[model samples]
Target chain A: MSSEGTQPLGRARPQETPAVAAPLLRRGMGNLATVAAHLVLMTWTVFVAFPFLWMVVTSFKTDQEIFFSPWRLPSALRWENFARAWTDASIGRYFLNSLIVVTGAMVLTLLCASMTAYALARFDFPGNRILYYCFLAGLMFPVFLALVPLFFVVRDLHLVGTFQGLIIVYTAYSLPFSIFFLHGFFRSLPGEVAEAAIVDGASPYRVFFDVMLPMAQPGLVAVGIFNFLGQWNQFILPLILMPNPDRYVLSQGLAFLAIQRGYESDWSALFAGLTITMLPTLIVYVFFQRRVQQGLTVGALKG
Target chain B: MHHHKYRLIIPFVLPSALIYGVFVLWPYAQALYFSLTRWRGFSRNRPFVGLDNFERMLDDRLFWNALEHNALMLVVLPSATVALSLLFSALIAQGGRGLRGAEIYRIVSFFPQVMSAVVIGVLWSFVFHPNIGVLNGFLRVIGLGSLQRTWLGDPQWVLWAIALVAVWSSVGFFMILFIAGMQSIPTDLYDAATVDGASRWRAFFGITLPLLRDHLQVAFVFMGLSALDLFALVQVMAENGGPSRAADVIARYMYDLAFNKSQFGYATAIGVVLLILSLVLSVLVVQLTQRERIEF
Candidate 1:
């Protein structure tokens, strides 16, 4: 209850200190209230995780088992469902398409966004503020607004339904956020490092690539993951631009599978396809949960 | 040095600017032009029809319905998501007691944010699938069978059902944001409140809520923007707007107009309206949230 004790908690360990104070404040609420809080948290955790768990479990169940025992665990591991989804169902093709486009877009976005961010952060130039605002303005304008004209633009370039086209669109669409997020990181970097490198006769390009880009690795990773998740999961843009089924990305392919539910098909493969579509992002998220969370929240809160 | 700095800046900035221009800015400018012309997106020849597309949009009942659906989502999604997120964040932050295992719960709750909206939509559509859906099965098992309804199929329930999915998908994110926001609040305020015999609710309303205004504002605006952009979910889950176009949102309607019906000019008008709406909301959010930052 002392000011002396609580002031330190306020300045240090912003994410951790609140936990130390919360329970004491809520002590009068007693064990039952605490238990109720736990219960609510656990229930929502289950609610959020269950659909994903269901997708994975259902992928291994036969149609009859899925229909008859919707809640029950699958009786056997049906690995073939994934096989079917991969081979016959074309989820494999879609997965490969996604891998190509997501990687291409992520790399392109990182390179360009970092370059732009570095310029805006480090250099003094005309139109710098205008260019920065131009990118930032893209944050509010939904891609749907650009869908029509963007479609025609890509079509006119003869890149429609091509990986290169989707890559360009995704890269362009993602640049706003990537540049905005990276600009902050670049601005925060000690100017002395870049200045010393430049004085050592490192060209501006070399100072950027050799010195600054590596220094901005964390920023790059955050923006990279952000653009990766976004481009991988994009549906509407691909749906419009990539009309060929052969070029369908994972999201577009999954939607295609869902819409084709009325056709005669293996329900298990469909579920497996859904699982296949979700696994890469989920696995990446599990590994880099902190970075992914930071990426998403930063884009929303700060950028 | 100054001239060199300026020259170098162009190389660094040009790639991003060019790509962004060709793809984003140019398309948007074309959207303006196309909105004025009575042109099908595919073929070139078209007469100029100034304001006609916008006029048609004003008269279109379906556009209004779709906009209304988006407005509903804009209100419901952010409120429900932020509310539940605030509660969950508070619970998870109550770490001194039995709720010590906050990390797992936090991670698990955020599991949905990592997945594609298309995947979430497909997954939830199956979860809400009529006969074999897990929701209905669980309802039946709980003997609440009569309460179960065709969630996405019925017009009355479709929007709510989609909104619920959105809330589920979104809560973890906002929860994380609020948790971060709350952590930055000094523990002294809570201590003072405790000494004053202020109840937990009172401390929350007076101390926590006011301090967290900036975070809440950001969350609301971001979530609102998302609410407007529900193309993937609506397209995948509700089958491009459920029965009677009940769950149809502006983005999906624009897609249908551009792609399905080939009403390119009209669709561009819809897109312009969508742009205007988003810009308006964003400006409003900035204006609303621009209260003097509380330094504490």
Candidate 2:
């Protein structure tokens, strides 16, 4: 980079002397730049991954090792930490609960949001634009903003502690992004096939179910995985609504274990619980990394 | 055709509409109403008290303090995330031509984005644990033992500790966003800049930043909202606002008010304030960043 001004490339273009030298200088700087860039990137990668690594390693250590030999590698696998987390710590129950709610919420949110997205994208009905914007508006309504009234709404229906209530909340919360994302997909889809289906005297519902919905499968998968990760990781709603120990989701469960066990000698068990709670989403992310990343950008960019 | 429109629209839209309305819209409207009432969490015969809650919030020190923390977050979080993201994305994008491992680095950096905030909070708490923590241990390893402090326990360090986690978790997502933005910039412009003797830094400021206005706006809005909704971190890490309410933000405070103290009405007022604050910030961000797209 420092050698740019004196390089022969600068003498070639007198009109823009500095401009002519830049490419050559950049070429020379490339090697040094790559090393520097890698240094920064590697440092950040370590910064990002080290905690997770520490969490896993710490989970394998006994209480004494964690407290005393914090930096040392565990001598044994200590798989029983996981057992303690799953059974005595109750993360297993919470994991099961999370799976049920997230699955139900994913399916229901996809169903409702996609159907609405399809309508808004395909049909020119009265209030179509209005309805689309209304769903879009849901994006701004953070869960905390409606916590008090929503608690009352759920409690009034006598579903406060029920999975059904949480599922409903998750579905509603996930709808805005789902609809917005799928709306773009539904709109971009070729209208020719769906038009032909309509011309064949197929019912509107049948056309959607049989034809357009299938065509929107990619979008569905994108939104489905997005909703799944979101619902799986949800904390605030479950924390407020599911006070019952039996019904705690993974996030709430992990938090509970952290607080309850933080003061005890059960630190490794807490780490184990954190690891278990993080596993599903981590697997999903690792497997479907591209799709997950794209889904995140799709909502932000498209909206 | 007109009749068919309504037939298809109603069925397709009703399910989502009803759920969204009942869960989101109705509660929001009810929040607006509840903000004006003197109802406790369980009371049915709530009496109307117009603007009293808002008036109380005005005089509430804890509310103001929480708001101040949130305001600090709103300022610091997005700026840090955007700056770091831009730096990382630029390196990955330009990377001095053929920088190896950009793809791997990108993937690795995004690891935290996949985990839940609760997990991040728990893991960070362990990282900041005074005796057993990696951070303090590292400080001691490097002979900087005096610098090691209780990160989340000290009221002074707690908010910064939480903000660091926020930045850590979010930097990759925004980096991905900026990478997309940077990649879309026509390479010929950079080539031209190179040919014109512009330095990499000059090209970045002159060419890259101007084109990434839209992505920056998106980042600002998203990070701002995340800042305002920072409950999981503070809750799990600091054990609800940390020492002396040093790290308390609006969302956690509202949660405590409603759930802990049963001050449903007061909490609703806080929620309303948060809602309006978020809405205002969002609109302002959009308006502030609204500029004509420079077509390449």
Best by TM-score: 1
**B1-296 per-residue lDDT for model 2 (tens digits):** 78877888888889899999999889877888988888775868678999999999988999999999999999999999999999988777665345666767778788788889998998999899998899999899889999999988899999999999999999998887777666656556878887798877888888888777878888999999999989999999887689999999999999999999998888988988888998899899887777434333
Who wins the lDDT comparison?
2
Query: Ten residues in a row with the worst lDDT in model 2 chain A?
Result: A1-10
**Candidate 1 C-alpha lDDT tens digits along A1-303:** 122222232232224565545635565557787788888988888888887787788989999998899888999999999999899889999999999998888888888898889889877767889999999888767777788889888988999989999898889999888888888889889889888987888887888888888999987887888878878888888888988999898888888988785366578999988888877887899899876876676566665
Model 1 error, position B151 (Å):
2.3
> DockQ for all models, in order?
0.57, 0.50
| lDDT for each candidate structure | 0.82, 0.84
CAPRI-style docking class of model 1 based on DockQ = medium
Clashing pairs in 1: none
Off by over 4 Å in 2: A1-27, A199-201, B1-7, B291-296
Task: Report the TM-score of the second chain of model 2 against its true counterpart.
Answer: 0.93
- Give the alpha carbon lDDT tens digit for every residue of B1-296 in model 1: 78778777887789999999999999988888888888774678867999999888888899999999998889898888888999988776644445577888778887788888888888988889887688999899999999898898999998888889889998988887777667767777788888798877887888888777767888888888989888888888788689999999989998998899888888988888988998899888767766544333
**For model 1, what is the error of residue B66's alpha carbon versus the real structure, in angstroms, after optimal superposition?**
1.3
> Which pairs of residues collide in model 2?
A18-B197, A19-B196, A19-B197
